[model samples]
Target: MATADPYGPVHTEGNAVPPLDPDLAGALDDLAGIHPGIDLIRDGIRHLALDRHTPDTTQTLLATLAGSSGADAITAIGHLIARLANADHNPALRGLPLDTQKQAQRHGEQAAFHLNDPTLHQPASEASAAITGT
Candidate 1:
């Protein structure tokens, strides 16, 4: 099992940090494609946290979650939720029509619900156990 890349390679010299497992990396890529704003929001939060010089609970929690397989999906979903909510309040998003804003809000709510869904957080072994009643 590989680890998460906390410090993404700047020089691009074959990635200085350890890479995430192939499956997790692929899943993260797929999620980013589905929610285009997820990466933007994640990067923004990370930058802001670093700039503030204060404890970043969100970053810390996500890093901890990334330690395990499948947890990155939950973290990505959470970032999508945050992105939607942030866009809804941002002045730039105001330029969008009312219907578009409503759509974004709806997407955010849906993501939030998905984030709260218990099954999303369950490990495969745990899920299998529940299914088999073992």
Candidate 2:
């Protein structure tokens, strides 16, 4: 079924960490559920110190979320990360050559096309195909 690996390799060699999206989603879910001093997490993220801690910061956030009762917080985190992932301000992604970004976007779009199965939505397809006796 080739399920997507949400925490797969980050495209950097030899590092054993999952992608950033999972981490962000996990952290946000925990914070909102616990109602912790999310401001602190925000402050830490704003300072770019997260890069310094490498895996520690991410590990901690994920651990916190794991322990919290707000298990659904991961969904909230995804919402936050989707905003970041789509934002033009992130030079980390936007700095890439336009063609490179376009290629990645195309990959996503193509996957969506298959998953959506446009054939099912065809305007004038034979509705009896499901009951074909021919």
Which candidate has the top score in lDDT?
1
User: What is model 1's C-alpha RMSD?
Assistant: 12.4
lDDT value for candidate 2?
0.46
lDDT of 1 by residue, 29-70 (tens): 665644557677555544543443323444444434442233
What is candidate 2's lDDT per residue for 5-124, written digit by digit as tens? Answer: 899756565553434576775665556634355766655554443353434444444433322222323434533444444325345678778887666555545544443343423311
Full-model lDDT for every candidate: 0.56, 0.46
User: Could you tell me how far off, in angstroms, the CA of residue 80 lies in candidate 2 after the best superposition?
Assistant: 13
Give the per-residue Cα lDDT of candidate 2 at 79.
39
Off by over 4 Å in 2: 1-92, 118-134
RMSD of 2: 20.3
TM-score of 1: 0.39
